[model samples]
Target: MTVREDVHSAGIPVLCQSCEARHRGVCGALDPDQLVALAKTSSKHRVEPGIELIGDAETVDSYSNVLSGVVKLTKSLSDGRQQIVGLQFAPDFLGRPFKVESAINAEAATAVSLCSFPKAAIERLMKESPELEHRLLKQTLNELDEARDWMLTLGRKTAAEKVTSFLLMIARNIDPTVNPTAKSATFDLPLTRADIADFLGLTIETVSRQLTRLRMDGVIRIENNRHLTIDSLSRLERRSGA
Candidate 1:
């Protein structure tokens, strides 16, 4: 199974990985001892929903990797409108890796779980392991890919297309890289109407209107405000042009 790689989370705590070759999840480099040391030094953290996990333009003491739930990397404009720059799921890292401070606000879109590691210790570990650096580079590439995809989603897709596209993007419970044939998946929704509007470049009214239309049309069955159940994956995929 393809696993979700961890980013350097700015919020949350760190955890241990026994019987592991890397300190974090499948970091792809590092020996067992190095992984153990990293895990030992890292601490775990939890946050309730709607909390700011990482403040805007603030330097964090360490980095983090998400264990569960969702997070939004957002930013505010001069007009006081907050835009969600990134939406992160589990096994993803959160903090600024090379930079001392993060550029956006890291908020818990849902109740979040994660692990944090001291930046100083991580920097020291990097000096000892060039292999870890390579792994970090790979992680950086993955993050860039995600960013590019979001750019397309935000810049190109239409409203109906955007909602359908969003469903397709989150359709799989497994890694997007390895699960092409894996349909019939389940995962959690990361954004509220406000968050969705900001991410989709639509207003709250537009987002709610679109969602109400979708539910009325039977494109999806909403178990509640937070949970969604897809009645027809093929239909949704067709709508998304996937």
Candidate 2:
């Protein structure tokens, strides 16, 4: 069978059990017929962290759902500076709705799993499936809200606050099997300090320093340079004033 056929039949493998009918997918709005149509128009791929997912200002064949891992959406100025615009975790859609046909040069910050869907097929699904359309609308609204919140992180939060918020957000987005808070809740620090710097509007050194401070202050523990463990989540949350 074809890849599309396989994904359609299997559905997304990374759903969270506690909430929502679909995780990291848009199939909640699709009936079997709509699913079949979608199944005919999607593909899956894996990529390591630091690989590029979409090129800047480049159009693509389709959109994607982040099945596993994390994606950092970003842009660069005329100078050499780069800014990570957003983060997309498992069960999240990477592309925008009814906006740009191509990405603005987004990249994966970790080993990522992706489900691709043809834009034409998505448009077709939207037209024929009102539920799918409505679901997509809700997704768009949610994204907007998230963007505004990120703006607050950038504009208002402290270095420790940014790091804490990022860690917490990452924790909440993954599957429970991953156990984000377990015995320190080890998980990959998908984005590098440089990526964090850009995304959070701080210097790379600041990011590094903040991480070190978090570790030293008994707020977190670093493992093998990639996985992060929250030593005292309550303290960290207090740091964020959350």
Q: Estimate each model's TM-score.
A: 0.80, 0.83
| Whole-model lDDT, model 2 | 0.71
lDDT by residue (tens digit), candidate 2, 162-217: 87888777766654346555544557777777767767777988888888988888
- State the lDDT at 75 in candidate 1: 87
Candidate 2 stretches with Cα past 4 Å from truth are 1-24, 174-184
Model 1, range 1-242, lDDT digits (tens) per residue?
11223432333213243211134443436565666667657666677888888887788778766766778888888798777777776556677677878788988877776667788877777888998777677777888997887788778877877777776666653233334475454555677777788788888888777778888998887766757777567778787644
In the predicted model 2, the residue pairs found to clash are 24-91, 182-185
